[model samples]
Target: MIKPTLDEEKKETKFSKKYWKYDGLHVISFTKAGLREENQDGISIEFELNDKLKESDDRLKGYYLFGVYDGHGEHGDKISDDCVEHLSKYIAKRLYELPIVENEKEIKNAIKKGFDDTENYFKTHDINGIKGNKVRMSGTTALTVMMTPKKNLYIAFVGDSSVFFMSSNKSKKINIEHNCHNQNELLRLRALRQKGFMYSIKARSGRKYLRVKDDLSNEIQYTRSFSDFYIKNFFSGGLIAEPEIIDKVYSAFNLDLLVLASDGITDRSKIFNKHPTEIYLSYLKRYKGDPNRFVKACDEMIKLCDSITEKRICVDDMSIIIIIILNGKSEDEWCHIVTKNAEDPEDWDNTTHEDELSDIDDQDIYNQNSNEVDDFLVSVPLSTIPIEYYDEDSAMNFTISDDDNFD
Candidate 1:
């Protein structure tokens, strides 16, 4: 794959702070560190592909890309910023060499490899080393989605960042979070024989969570990420750098809105007072699927987070990208084709609003019940503590300690 020019601006002010667009797709993204001292979140929405690339390959013509990165640790900012700067260029180069067929699998693989290449570059590079001349390790949850000309959707992700497709009737989540407390993630860890080294802790807030330690006896909580910690043998492959990939083709675009967000945007413990789904659906309805209203909608959400200092129980980095798919198109013409039904509720399936809520709740029961505190894993690396602790527990027997409490 041919790599794009690396003229990535390191200064934060160099990137666009508003939106990106193509023919019918419009994206609006915003990010802030919230109460944190520095912002560690990174984001990129590339709906406008290069004209030359589109001309060379018709398949690349109308594809749109959206991504979010929530970085952690000392160099968290660098990791997220670097990934956003580089990943698209990586994918474009890869696609340039492939045959121009409508191959969803190949496109997904190319995206996966782009993620892999970016992570590998950081892990092996000596750019972010500490005073002791040792490399510093940090990680970020990544969520990315690509929308093609054919309306084929491909999602690639790691950690707790999320993507969702919404309609007037229902909203569906598009990504899975990789956390030690997640049953599916725990099962994968067990299959990798890494579960034995994991231990659970009860926080002062009455929440129970898990942690994995580095050789220096530092702890981490998230199971999968784009970090060098796993490569340095600080954790197992279960806390992998690779992302889970998903591919699907759409016959017509039934989606009214597409939301991509970091954990900060969805944390229910905070003063936001409402769920992301409810807020998003309400925003879509308020705007009547108008793409121009996106900036105002996002601004309103940001105001909700900023207005919460008095009752602020939870605060972290927040980033969100909203895509209004029906923008510039006749919603009346496309709605029926997309939903495959008339707009009137009485003519549709016989279900009450209560029944609709129940169906949604049943389908996404696990996510709906998950706590915001579980979104992060204990990720204290060896550099955070004394070397003596490592010597005392060099055997690395995965067991709980008296200091495991978070309160």
Candidate 2:
């Protein structure tokens, strides 16, 4: 138990909530760690939630799982805590109720509904004392993955939290992050700012601000025209909509490993280390199949990722879940294939980075040809506090199939 001294007595925290789920085929374990740093701006809290799901009973049902949830804010702890728990329980409960089948569309709807409902649930509840009841509001970004034996896998996202999949064919990355950074989103932010609307916080590297992010412009835009926080921070990852599909079907792509994480771990390939999964896996291959060692390796990697002197979240509460598909291609196979096919123009541009792609996301690999076009339009969009269009009409915000599979 944690006790408070006289100075801390007045600011004691007495709140806790939890949720978990594991099937007969896999053993999923998660560990959380965080850092609180003092800054001139204010107190910023950065934390990471990690997960490892392994096939427990084996029996062909076991597979390993990896995931991370990094949220910012001193009081957003409740939101982060709630998001992880809600995410796990929501996915488990919905999957448990679904019929055994490879209906990718059904799986999509299940996840979409889970997020939509979760957001609605929070909106309807009276979160009076949850965060602090004084900081205007408190919440968190949601990033998660679910791997199943039916030769399936799925992921959901709310913010910049990302995923990377590795396979012999290729490695894949996705911007499931539906924020103001998308092509249209950037234009919108600019229009809004030009119209006199934008978050007030300055964009900085080390400081964690409640302000929204504009992809085109690192800092939130400012103009004298349209100023709608609801529209400015317009997209949400929490319980609003189904996380944009990073990869819709994992098995279809023949993925070998996956890495799900928050932006803090390795943000901007141009900045921090470009690939931690590759780095960790390089040293971890010899210890495959052991949960204890696997977990230890993960924790150690996180510590190495963090730096106490770093102003920002060193590896910022980094969380990473690595899933190793039993028969998936090995790193050597992938490297050999890449080198062999490097000059194969016909295959190079279209290569899905199979080994890396599958585990990173549940992307619709078959639609890779189409997604390439989307890559051009890729941008991050943000959502406002009480989403501008959040109401009875919000249902229309999602143009999902009534019969998701029918279409």
Best by TM-score: 1
Off by over 4 Å in 2: 1-34, 37-67, 127-136, 176-181, 187-242, 268-273, 285-300, 308-315, 328-407
Write one digit per residue (lDDT tens) for candidate 2, span 254-347.
6655666554443322132235455445434433445443444454444444432132212234444454444544434433442332222232
Cα misplacement distance, residue 69 of candidate 1 (Å): 0.4
Candidate 2: lDDT of 119? 61
Q: Which candidate tops lDDT?
A: 1
Model 1: worst 10 consecutive residues (lDDT sum): 357-366
Error of 1 at 258 (Å): 0.6
